[model samples]
Target: MDNTFDKKHGHELLKKPQFFFGMLLIMSLLGYVVAKGGVVSGIGILAMPIVISYVYLIFAIPNTGIIGIYILNFVAIGIVRYVKGVPLGLTIDAQFLLIYLALFFKTFFHKIPWANAKNDLVLLAAIWYGYALVQLVNPEAASRIAWFYAMRSVSLYMLFTVPLIFILFHKKKDLELLFKIWAILSILATIKGIAQKMFGVDAFEQAWLDAGNASTHLLFGKLRVFSFYSDAGQFGAAQGHAGVVFILLALSQKRSRRLKIFYIIAGVLGLYGLMISGTRGAIAVPVMGFALYTVLQKKTKLVLMGAIMGISVLVFFKYTTIAQGNPTVRRMRTAFDPNNPSLQVRLANQRKLKSYLASRPLGGGIGSAGNWGLRFTPHTFLANTATDSWYVMIWAEQGVIGLWLHLFILFYILTKSVYMIMFKLKDEEIKGMLSPLVCGFFGIMAASYGNGVLGQMPTGLLIYSSMGYLFLGTKLEKENLAIKAKEQLELAQCNK
Candidate 1:
């Protein structure tokens, strides 16, 4: 056998012994716990399987590539909160570390490709990470512990995920795989949400509601229907994000009939999830997303059509009193009303925040302003006042400088994506594929103005990965065009 083949064979051969030893080690640990503690210890031993599987999955993610890890990250965030006692939510960090470990070894062995390692997006991520690190020394920071708790989602995850996606998930098929996974998950989330709406909450869900969550989740005596997500805001905005993507994907030309059908189904279900979650802020996602999508089309006729449709929807909600009897429509209608009490409250809170933060250019520090602030330093003004918007939360924690940098990073990514869609990309299919995702990102960004949902799990991951893929679209399209041109030349030469 060849040397490379023999090495690979040996690697496989070693896996069995490693597996056996792993199991033996787990059993020994369980036995020790039992010896030290008894039945209580034996009960605690149940976590061994979760730990073993979690370790196995971390190593497994590299073989599945970037999309695989994204899907795993999505699934983990979607359900980990419901899984009691295991702290499975934090295992994602382990996955991130394991990926870096694998990449390091692969590089050492000359098996890792470095060609795709450099990009403007990757550079932007590095810059963002650097800014986040500097915040550790902010003079106004109340608690370093809170920064540790909150910064993972803020800058650390972005540092690793952006480069990883650039390395592995730049292909058109990878985009399709991403769409398939996202659509399926959105549909399933809607299904679970619908069950909660029609049937009722389960034991875990009901327990959560009863344990002080009901105050926020229940509005006007109607359930918010969060489903398996972190909360109703996440569920609603995420569903709306999916709805916009799939609906636009469905409308794109040259797609297969089956794909169109799949998109339509997913889009409808996603919209339903958005409706039932009663997340009024989520309505901004589709409205703003579709507006951006139309603008990106750059066709006078399509732009006119999109404008007319958008105006009609707004007019219906603002001018007409129709459908006031329907609860869903009624709640949605409130989103447009400027004088709505909640809107007033939000504005008043912003005023208060502006007054407090006027002098602190660095703000209070990352974790000193949100839920982490409340838990770690309850007496802080930002924590008690509620930074309802993601932007507000960023402003409260990072101060003006940090918030502006974050905004500039996002704006740069979105602007670059638009520039690629408009001028650089030549393949219609590729252009069509990226347009909605970029637009959807804009929508989520807009929605985040009303809620602190963007930097949380799944949404943050989705947006970061989308940014990588959107940037990669131009590269993939150029390669595709080159191949096509070469094939045409070859055919002509053969005919001559």
Candidate 2:
């Protein structure tokens, strides 16, 4: 009876053979891997726990994953400079996959409001991605890898980004946050460019210049100022796009004085970055963006003022010798010249491409014309044909059909956005915020006519994000009205 008063508990792990032996086997295998592969494998093993937490974080806070994507879009290409052979791109793909996995797990407790993503923007992205996918079997395709690389920016990112934004990040605060993030990054980029301009290139940047980039980045003994971006052309265009959006933002606001100052400073920095980049086409970003922005304003007097300002800029560049001593202005001034050597070169390339693509309506393939073309299929006709313009690259790779479809999608989006901004939306603040995005988009489209920045990093993702937010403008306006109504009712009741 006394012996029955006490009981003994066995070790739980010892009781379960699977649990005991499984961990032992895993440890043994991991030890073998670390012994064979050395420190790198051990580092990876140590990092596994951290990687596993990605799902927890993503599901817990949806926008964390989304913002990660934004950060990746900015920094992905820059990784190539440091990590030589390893594909840093895998990180992006892995991040996207983890995001989707997190979203999947979230379905156990909550429904992802699919209807919010059911819009023309998402549909258009899908259609474009579908088109890119079809190129996998194109007869003219010489490199499947190139198609894989090209389509991600050309369509896949748009497809992935648009729906995620609609479903998760569609609020007004999300937009404000996005703008702030964009402005901060743009400002940082300018500062970096300024650093490079004043202090000279670092070892990595110098190495980059040594590897054929010197020809472009170091033009005629002068630095073209690529900053930290993939190239000067991209740096210039991205800055120009940001510059216009922020400057326009400052102009549109009246009450938000601090915000206005922030916008102005960011805008000015972006313009300075663009100038130092020495990419002639970047000037068109502000020119075309402001043109569209003035129209979006829908006030006759403001429109007239915008026109006057535009004409003044055009005249200043075209007619006057103002600031000819300044390298940036002198470089930008050439963009207005029809007979400029660079313009002539571009024209010649287009003509050659026209003849080559005469028989093949789909052009060469998804990645047959741009930087990827040079990498994957350098011997191909499309690869050798310098596709200076983003639209031209699309045409050279995806053909006339792709170009027309792309144009239609872009124009349709702009038209719809304009209509909503002018008549449907009532909130001045929301409308004003959206105006720069719309204008920036138009500006980028215009810039794409001269540089392949449209489908490039930072710009493509930014534009896709902007498009998604622009479509949600009406919803944001509704929320603003509801909040305002609540505030007014509370005020009246308090007075009573």
Best by TM-score: 2
**Highest lDDT against the true fold, candidate:** 2
lDDT value, residue 198 of candidate 1: 92
User: Cα RMSD for candidate 2?
Assistant: 4.1
Clash number by candidate, in order: 0, 0
lDDT of 2 by residue, 145-224 (tens): 99988888788888888898898899988988888888998898889899999999989888999988898888767799
TM-score of 1: 0.88
lDDT of each: 0.83, 0.87
Give TM-scores for every candidate, taking all chains together and pairing residue i with residue i: 0.88, 0.90
Worst 10 residues of 2 by lDDT: 4-13
TM-score of candidate 2 to 2 decimals = 0.90
Off by over 4 Å in 1: 1-68, 253-255, 482-496
